[model samples]
Target chain A: MYNKQYLNFLSGLILLFLSHSLMANVITIEITGTPFNPIKIAVVPFQWQGQNLPPAEIASIITSDLYRSGRFNPIKETELTSKPVKGSEIVFADWEKLDVDYVVVGQLNQRNSKYEIRFELFDVFRGEQLSGYNIPSRTKQLRNNAHVISDIIYEKITGQKGDFATQVAYVTAIKKQKQLQYSLHIADSDGYNAQQIVISDEPLLSPAWSPDASKIAYVSYEDHRPLVYIQETATGKKKKVISFFKGINGAPAWSPDGKKLALTLSQGDNPDIYIIDLANNSRTRLTKSFAIDTEPAWSPDGRFIIFTSDRGGKPQLYRVPSIGGRIQRLTFDGEYNARASYSPNGQNIVMVRGEGGKFQIAVLDLGTGFLRILTPGNLDESPSFSPNGNMIIYATENQGKGILAAVSLDGSVHQRLKLQQGSVREPVWAPYGRSR
Target chain B: MNQIKLLSTGLCVLVLSGCGLFGEKVEETDITEETTQTQQQTTPSQETTQPTGQQVQPQTNNVTTNNNGNTGQQSNNAVTQGLGNRPNTQLNEIKEPITPPTERTIYFDFDKSLVRSDMQNILAKHALYLSENPRATIVLEGHADERGTREYNLALGERRARAVKQVLILQGAYADQIEMVSYGEEKPVSLSHDDESWALNRRVEFVYQGQ
Candidate 1:
């Protein structure tokens, strides 16, 4: 759905989101569509030319990445009649009999302490090699390199940018007897290589990545009140953005330029939206309603900001100018809509739609005013767009537990990354690059 | 790969008694206002029609004498004799027989900030206890169920707590004596996913600081 130029330009604004609180909630999945005509692909196990083996299962990683995208269904490793290391070895008749449309073949070898990874994508029907890469890498970079391979093969076939190389940050919690342990974690998009960023006895929510991917801004209750804190991803150091306030101080959204944050501060017995300029420590109040006005997200273009407010009775999505002006209602299809944000293209808004207490992720096209409900689950929230505007990641509750789930924009592809023991929610997909 | 262990930052209990701002220690809030004029105007709740307001707060010396643990103390509870039963400062100290209500929690409906009507009596009882004991401070831990988004739930939790706080202040409790912190949907009393469990988790808890 996104091009390379757009992905490169959109790399900075990967919408950083949250993980499920450590509830250990297993993913509740319905196992929906497969893109109508699913692409049948085969990634043969890579040939190892070095002693022992490479740190990663390169072929399996690429296979899993494509399958997770819900676009390609890679054949099982057991189904491969012959393992091919190059284009000439691939027997097109064998793949045609098996009905695989595309094939990925690769070899890995140690060259002067650097792992040389070579791979080629082939259109089995045309019997032509579509793409190939000869890359030089190191030991630790192998896993990431596998994802890099996945991106190339995925893009070659789907004609869209791949998000496998991107990172995701979410908050997870594990209960230790009488105490609830909370920790913020960042992991690969596939729910692997998770690294904990911060831990507190209190709750942490709404993690926003800096445009540069160097820092994350989240709300923590460690000080016994919800206050916004910006933490350096490289360091555990953090400082409260606001000195102290009498009431609620939560919901932090970084501006596209990263110089400002639109926040929700409850001062006069009600919550309202305020923009804080980081340079001079100045604050701009956007919405001054007695109703609950919260969950502020700036548009990708930074021209406007969308928020959830109950000024219209039930909570609904409202759009206002970024500099503060006349407000307009965006969604009337649902009785309850909140935690809304813009797609990287700024043409659509993803939000949590609730009616009759059953909530799920929904998307509203900015041009047509048509609301398309994505997830079918009753309890789903915190919908965030991948930087390329291809997939939307959110948290959903299954059975009695919380887990992370993602659905493509067209509601065709659904993937659940509930591999962790505890439940995870509030998953925000990182943009094009790695997190610092 | 540079994963820093934050146990030390969380273990700041050794350095700072309370988790105030980051290196910004907050002085104890000043909640002692001794004027008692608008008792009739504020909090015209159905359960507690007559609120004595500041006049009901007992003095420091008499508060020490009333142990309030006696089984007989339950007989003079908040609804009956405790609701403006002993008026003014003189009788408040001697007749302040109502022990702090054992039930300290008040639950709210889904996404609702207003405390339920049935829970009003519990808050009234707690307000009466606060009115009688001005020296004692309680922190209201606001919480929401794990149904909604975290940040929105955080805001909702605070609204529920502040709703109770406003009621307490209107009834008789000093504003400064009650502190609030919303855990949002982060901390759940019930881990189950059904309505009963979510109902149990959405509440405000009365946590008295120090003995």
Candidate 2:
């Protein structure tokens, strides 16, 4: 009896140790959407004329990107009656019979180290090419060329710029034994090819991308204190931009022009919003209130700085001039609304709204003052708008582990991105530009 | 063995008399010394409070010898005995534990920073200890429940820390002795999403330096 009890206790200890070491691996993105009359389109598989197969399938990538947008329903390649590599080789009658409104056809040719990618968007009804582009890129740039092609096709069809070519930065945390490992990662907007920009044994939070998408600023607690650091995305080189502050050096948001960063500092009695000029590290205090004020996001035009403040009791969104002037309260609908970022066009603002003890993502129309809740999850935060203002990516919890999630502005499309083992959070969508 | 018994009996008598004399001296001296001595007394007494089975036999013998010798110190013995015997009981009743820093975690209500009545005595104990130990320093790590945005929570955590700092400074702790850092909701002791877990997460943890 004594031996059995001892064995049971030993097994219990082993199980406990095993459970603590378990962690998720690479993140897998799960896309779910309720299509609301999605437009019918066909993306023909691009013919590869290279000796080595291109790194990634160009047509398939474009098809997945369009389908995930919740605006287009690309027919499967197996369902295609004929595959056309160019507009002149298209059979418009077959597509018309298939009820397809648009078709994308492309071909990839390799000339030594350079790749010649040609793609065209065709009007299936008119039997004519609506748009065509010949993009010349290196072998390694094939995937990016695919995204750019997807963007062009999306723009030609929807009249809105596509965010496929953009990237996202987020923080991932994994518990190993008694230590917590944190990594800041930058990946394509589709959550592929993630590269760790910074990794530490301590916690990392609040990653903010620069407007040009070349640099990222985030808070690191490696020294057991919160300090802001900016890193070049392409080179993975970082510098401690703001440290040695008495209290917090957090919430770093790059201005629209990328020359200045608006952040929250608490060297004084209370936390307040402050903008630091990147050139000289000179700071200009924006809010002068005893209440907590933080999460400063700049307007697209760089005219106003919107932030979250609890000056009026509960935390709400507030706006002030970039150069420090009158402060105006911007949100009044909810008891808790914060972490707001502007859409690329500056017509709407997406923020995390808390009501009935559940926090979710919501968008407030600036012109109409209409608030629309975009997510159904209970604990959603860090809402960042895609560069083209078509989708909002945020962090949400699943089974007590943090996960990255994105929702279309209209709330029609939803995608959950999660690592196989660990937790990821604080996703910031990079702006549209040619950076990597 | 007879001599040991007699010495213990005599030590108890000395402790009782010492308590009487030391209580009077505490009233005469300033607040810092009184609290500092009280905290110094607590360290040895806490060791004795632990289960005797877990204590090494030699260590316990050493403690007994130290106690016998300390009893001969008169007023200091009285203060030490008073603190060791009762811990923070009297201080809790008085709501001013000008004795020692015993509490480490200061909890707050959801989205609120006003230190609750139950936590006042604990904060008072910390304040008294800090006020007494001039060279001693502490870091107040403030945290918040995972209900709001990250940046806003960061500010909230700082507010809670500042609230604790204000209480400590008001109670005589040196302004420079306490450093505050807010971790917001990034680090949580409890990972559960329920109210109980959140209450545990929203707290100010007092970490002493050179421990």
Candidate 3:
């Protein structure tokens, strides 16, 4: 009797899987790594008990998020023998037979006007619930809530925090009537619901997120000059922070403490890195070199500032004390390297590495002093690490138009985030939550 | 001396006619005629008075004399000199056309900001023009090919512009008359991704104000 029932359940799962695959026009991730095998897991579709359908699909978001990390291979929903919406309903034997190591089940309940999501993650081998969460969110915030659940499940299993709930800020360039229109945009890590934070006809470059993720600092070329501005991400209000300089005032990088910005200022000579205190507006020169020194990125600990300098005759990564002291060269592999950003843990640095005639994204391990090339594009640049340090997003050209692309740090997973009618660039991943 | 004069006048006519093909639209015919006439009068004295090795000295003197005679017409001659050829003979004579400047772009090597040896004479011409015209101003717009980081490219562009500015300053161009702005790789004269297009894009352009 149980064998006949299992056959019937398998057929039903096959039908549901075909239906879901046909209906969902999801942004699929293209993973490319042969040496590493991803963990197998199953994310069951959440039960919808609310009066109206949810704004975002919770299970699919978690599935894509986990799959994009290149660490988890989410099982097809149709492969499940039974649809479990809670921990009590989960059948470990069925999941074990399907070869999935873990399973995620959830239920979305509406309490008056608010929505609550209760999710349970189970270890199919152990046949026990590993973790659970009841997250309350608004209808519009359901996508973020789903990401939060993915984060919880990911951390519980992998022992590393997931950056699914974080945001990515990038610049988009649209050619309109013989002129390029540039805009700064902030979107979810999965590249959904992108909102323009600032727009101008002039070119916008080098966007840096503050520690709290409440503000973004970028370089804007308005009034025929490059000026740095700090704008609140939520309100869209901005203030010109460094416009009075005669020469270049650009590459604003927020310090870890959010008290200052390390920037590049030429002042009619060779450009050098400088740190500007946001409180009193006092500027301190960092590197005194005749070679070009720019693109300053602060360490996560705020103890050192890594910047791009061509003092060795080619653009390479260098580090200096935050308060200004001896400068040390960091990168020695490639002929050209620049725009280095520290990983969240500060163990590795992601940067644009140019070799032969092509530029691609690469990472430098600080401890091992080895460089790993992560991209295979001719013109890839502006690499920013996800807050969890799992993925690196950067700008690359496709058919002569700029588009954003993300790759797993190990180069196992790759995904492209493209706009419908314009080019995107300079993607900077926002920091984790404010509480961190 | 007469043969040299006749040869120089003939050469001047050939150069001016060539300039008429690419000279500024407003000064096309006038520049050709005025430059031919000035060369007829100035060439004989310049060629006869100067030693063979000092050809550039007489040419520079003749350009200044023509400027004193008719500034507008002589400026047109300077423009013709800039547009005619590579100035293999008289570098200073080709350099004096400040008001109606013709040679604007200065090209550079890949990832380099130093003023090329070939561009030095052209830059000197612009410098002499700016020095002669005190009220005149020009913006040195620097650019780079689509390679490397944008911010560093901006600085590289500035470095190229500053290199030109240094040459101009050394050649007596006023500090206030020259303003430098690095467009980096934002503006490209050629959009293709090749060596020729990149070479065209990696340049500093002299944009004269109130021209």
DockQ values, each candidate = 0.36, 0.53, 0.47
True interface contacts retained by model 1: 0.56
Writing each residue's lDDT as its tens digit, candidate 1 over A138-188 gives 866777788988888878887888778788889887777788777888877
DockQ for candidate 1, C-alpha atoms:
0.36
The lDDT of model 3 is 0.82
Look at candidate 2 and give me any clashing residue pairs.
A23-A421, A24-A420, A24-A421, A24-A422, A25-A421, A27-A419, B18-B78, B19-B78
TM-score of each: 0.77, 0.78, 0.78
Off by over 4 Å in 3: A1-37, A48-54, A108-116, A134-137, B1-99, B117-124, B190-192
Residue B80 of model 1: what lDDT? 24
Backbone steric clashes in candidate 2, count: 8
- Residue range A1-436, candidate 2, lDDT tens digits: 9999999988887665455333212556677886687889999999899763454578988987887788888888899999989888998999999999999998988888788999999998888898999999885577677888888888888898888988999998888886678999988887776788899998899998887888889999888888899999888888987875778888999988899999988883688889999999999999989888899999999999999988999989999999999999999987899988899899999999999998999999999999999899999998998888888999899999989999888889898887776888898898876756
In the range B1-211, model 2's lDDT, one tens digit per residue, is 9999999999998785553334422222111112333334534434323221211221112111212223313464454344323222121011232334667998999899999899999999899889998788999999999889877787788889999999999999998999998888888888789999999999999999877
Look at candidate 1 and tell me the lDDT of residue A345: 88
Order the candidates by DockQ, highest first — what do you get?
A: 2, 3, 1
lDDT of 3 by residue, B76-180 (tens): 534422212212222222233435468999999988999999988899899988898888899999999988899999999999999999899889988999899
lDDT tens readout by residue for model 3, A310-386: 99999998999998888998887779999999999999999999999999999888999888998999989999999
Candidate achieving higher DockQ, 1 or 3: 3
Q: For all candidates, what are the clash counts?
A: 15, 8, 1
Q: What's the iRMSD of model 2?
A: 1.1
